[model samples]
Target: MIDCISFFGLGKLGLPLAALFARSELRTLAIDIDRELVARLRAGQVPYPEPGLDDLLAEAEPRITYASEARGAFGTDASIILVPTPSDAGHPEFSSRHIEQACRDLCAALKARTEWRYHLIVISSTVFPGTVATRIAPLLEQLLGRRAGRDFGIAYVPDFVALGDVVRGFQEPQFLLIGSDDEESHAQAAALFRRIVAPGTPIQHLSIRDAELAKVAANVFLCTKISFGNFLAQLADRLGGADLDSIASALALDPRIGGGFLRAGSPYGGTCLPRDVDAFVALARSVDLDAPLASAVRDVNKAQYDLIERHLLAGNPRCVAVLGLSFKPGTSVTIGSPAFELVRRLAQRSVRVAVYDPAADARESAHAAFGDAITCHESITACVAAADAVLVCNSDPAFRGLAAKVAPDRRIIDPWGCVLGTHPGLVRIGRDQALAASLLASRRRKPSLRAVR
Candidate 1:
């Protein structure tokens, strides 16, 4: 019965969802306020670089339409709002202005309709708990002058897709969660997702408040796992004869602690994990509850970043190369990227830094972010060619086996253990012996102060 779908804010997540809906044989309309983005999308060009997005857009071109205004899509039976819910500046809460404006515009369009019928509105944006029920639902009703669950229905359904693998994630989700104010809204949303997802996909229905909390809670839990792994990695460094990779592998065997997000690497960064963890801590404090565990997770992550920076600085290499810029592999977005932060820190210390990423536009992104302070290279070999030290900040598959190619004399710092076995000049952060030896060798190679005198 749900044949038409309208998507608001067609950014990274929304675009793929819209394409998938169109691919599922539903007539889909993708709307955004950015005219340039809408123009590009209409020309069969993707505004952002996401793996498989171009192919999906092409496949759904026949059934998909791009628009710049919500008024153009009022004919659709359902609208899914995916606008940005940025974290408030100097606060733990999300800014509701974007979503609020989006709802107001949507209501204005719905008001223009000649006839009123049951319409479903699904919010796919991540918001603080009680946002849908307390804030959004009331705003929509006030604007449209219609009672919700009677004239219109609302559902909260946040997607759990990561940046690089969003398309594949939609096709094969571990579970589907729908939070609705009423059974009719829940059923309609569930029915639509069922058509798009694989048959028999597990779907859990809850109240709007629970769904909002669950979305952030899931991300916060993942952050905790990552921070715990980093803590273990630090322990391995302090305790002799311990390797984080080996220890993490052992921990993964236990069913309670899953294998995912357990890799000992750079501090977790990107759009979701870091901010959501902070938001969760804020939510706890808002209710007058102490979240020391969550707070500790953040503190541990900062320590991990500081540890890596300190290790990089200990080596007095005048020139250093960073091999990855984006937060993770398979996407070009550098928002909240550890590599970007590391590059900035190195530049601040007057260390000449060159960076590269196989998937990201390093030249444009790096230059825009750090302007003339850092050099951006197009390839891994070119980036490391002139540098005496190299840091593999991301676990991009392109960085695998990179150690075999680097000169034996140059120092290689790999926190993610992307490189294979030990090398004389290689220093793995979580493994102390290699790092100590690397430092010792560097110190011995330096000219003595007494000899200079």
Candidate 2:
């Protein structure tokens, strides 16, 4: 009977979800607080760059509507709040001001309605554990002057998709998690998702608090894998003749350690992984328990970044070129990008930095963030031409053949192993014997800057 749906907060995730809902033959109302963004969507233009999103939105435009207020969702069978729940500036917990504001507006919408019926509100945003049981549900109950299970239903089902592959992820999530204290509410949410997700997908129904904790724990586990891989790489560097890739491959065959994040290239740097790791640690401390493993995982990530920076600075280059800006190619989000962090660290030590990214969104973000401190280039060749050394950060396909194209005299730091056909100037992270020797050689003499010319 749930044929109509409304989405709140149409950013990268929300807008796509709305389009997918419409594609499923459900009338979707896409609402957001940003008038400019809403205006763009109305005109058939996507504000952000996501693969296949433009075409998907174009096809579903006939079934979707755009609005700027919560009132737009008035007649929908359900309203899913997908607003941002960013981490606190100096703390590990998430700030729920946005979620609370959205709920308050929805409550107001509920007040204006004359008919009495049950409306389900689903929260797809990431929040701290027990947030719904302690804060969100109580706020809604107090505001609407009605009980949750009797008059309204609330469900917590956070999205587990990456930025670049969000559209496909929605169509085929590994599993569907529906969390609600009310049995009827849980069944209703599950039924809605079953219509959209691929067949045979596992569905788990749990209490609201458990679902909140599960989301954070999942990301924290991924971080542990990445940090462990980096640790092996560091150990390999200390003990010569041990290739990290080969070791990873051998371990992956065990089935116990699959190749998800086992082979290390760079530190795990994104909006989710690092933040969730910290949040999990903080959550443990809040309960008077110590999360030493999570703490070590965080420390290992920092050490991996430091290790890369130290190697890049070994030759004391006057200027270095960074090849990638986005966290991992495919998207333009640079919130917790390791490449940006590298540029910042170099700038702090007075090393001039020039950067380039094939994605236009990443270029704009980098230009906006660093301003005059760093130079942004249009092409990979131009970016490399401006510096004494080149650092290939991400495995963007555009970066292929860079090793052979760049000046042979200039050193190239390729952490991701994107460039094939090794040259004397080419160096890789986690599996290069040349790096140790190069570090020793650089210490003996000052490197010439003429290689850049």
Candidate 1: C-alpha lDDT: 0.86
Error of 2 at 31 (Å): 0.6
Superposition error at 404 for model 1 (Å): 2.8
Clashing pairs in 1: none
lDDT of all predictions: 0.86, 0.85
Q: Write the per-residue lDDT of candidate 1 for residues 83-103, one digit (tens) a residue.
A: 999984387788777889889
Residue pairs with colliding backbones in model 2 are: none
Candidate 2 lDDT for residue 125 = 93
Candidate 2 lDDT by residue in tens digits, 107-133: 888777788688888999999898998
How close to the true structure is residue 138 of candidate 2, measured as C-alpha lDDT? 95
- Kindly give the stretch of ten consecutive residues in candidate 1 with the minimal lDDT sum: 444-453
The true-versus-predicted C-alpha distance at residue 245 of model 1, in Å, is 1.6
TM-score of each: 0.94, 0.94
Q: After superposition, how far is residue 4 of candidate 1 from its true place, in Å?
A: 1.1
